[model samples]
Target: MSELCRLWHVTVTVAGEEVEPLIVRNALRRLSDQRPFLHSLKYAGGRAEIQYWEEAESLLDASSLALRVWNEHRESAGLPRWEVVGLEVLERTVFLSRGMEYHVIVDLHDVTPLPF
Candidate 1:
């Protein structure tokens, strides 16, 4: 039996040329360091966005982490602060028919938490 694990997907957007991939990666690392509950670091699109998984016990906890990362970058002047535009339990099952991988569907919880 496959073990059921809670996962979270985080998407961060920054200008193509203005943002450095290393810096963004560092930021994600910092976030993960600060909160050890998350795992996996998959970066894509010229440092434009990143997605990772987290052991989210609830939507609120997951949302908090997302908000923190966004604010941290904004506070550090890493990127123009973008509000929590959207978040929700990702319902659709994503699969790569021709790849060495397996995919898991997560409960996407959309959150537009008020800025702190």
Candidate 2:
């Protein structure tokens, strides 16, 4: 039987040498523009949090991709040369069960840039 893909919510946090806040913000905005599926982005001068959904056959596959997201987009997105400091991957159902307050309901078509 073919493995069925499942949706996994991924949150990746990266941190490195500090840079200007505007530079980080703009890079994140560019990243969001390039990857519209991103649910939300939050950043400071030295760190950032990226949230999105990944469709894969297992948590391992999903987390693997999540781990590479930053480096893969670094050049095109102009993201900082940072190290991924944290990662969280949860099945879609489990993610939602965490309650409304823990997440933001984002309309993919209308993503707004948020400040740190």
Candidate 3:
């Protein structure tokens, strides 16, 4: 089989209240918690992001889970919708950690943003 690697780095931007970002962050945390396979979300380059090892076996499933959070909170967040401008797929080998970091979202409430 092809070497499994989907070290996805997704960025989402919300178009409403400042708390909107938190909504997305929290949802992602919950998602990672539920699936245990999907890693927690992160913030980078003025966007909320995440990286996972594609343990879901299907990138589409991973992508859907990311979008699902926005759908679940669209109404209450006062957000018309969130925009996923890009899902930056990269070679897993690029990360110094060598993709050994497909970890669960630990604490979204206090995650520092990764420098762009």
Q: What TM-score, over all chains together, does every model reach?
A: 0.39, 0.86, 0.43
The 10 consecutive residues of candidate 2 with the worst lDDT sum are: 105-114
Q: Sort by lDDT, best first: what order?
A: 2, 3, 1
RMSD of 2: 2.9
Give candidate 2's TM-score. 0.86
- In terms of TM-score, which candidate is stronger, 1 or 2? 2
Residue pairs in candidate 2 whose N, alpha carbon or C atoms collide under 3 angstroms: none
Put down candidate 3 lDDT per residue, 56-91, tens digits, no spaces.
335565566655555565555333344665564433
TM-score, cand. 1: 0.39
Which candidate gets the maximum lDDT versus the true structure? 2
lDDT of 3: 0.48
Model 1: residues >4 Å from true position, as ranges? 1-17, 44-69, 72-80, 90-116
* Rank by TM-score (best first): 2, 3, 1
For residues 1-116, write the lDDT of model 2, one tens digit per residue: 24699988888989999988889888988899888888778888889888888999999999999999899999999999999999999898988888742546555423344465
| Model 2 stretches with alpha carbons more than 4 Å out | 1-3, 106-116
Residue pairs in steric clash, candidate 3? none
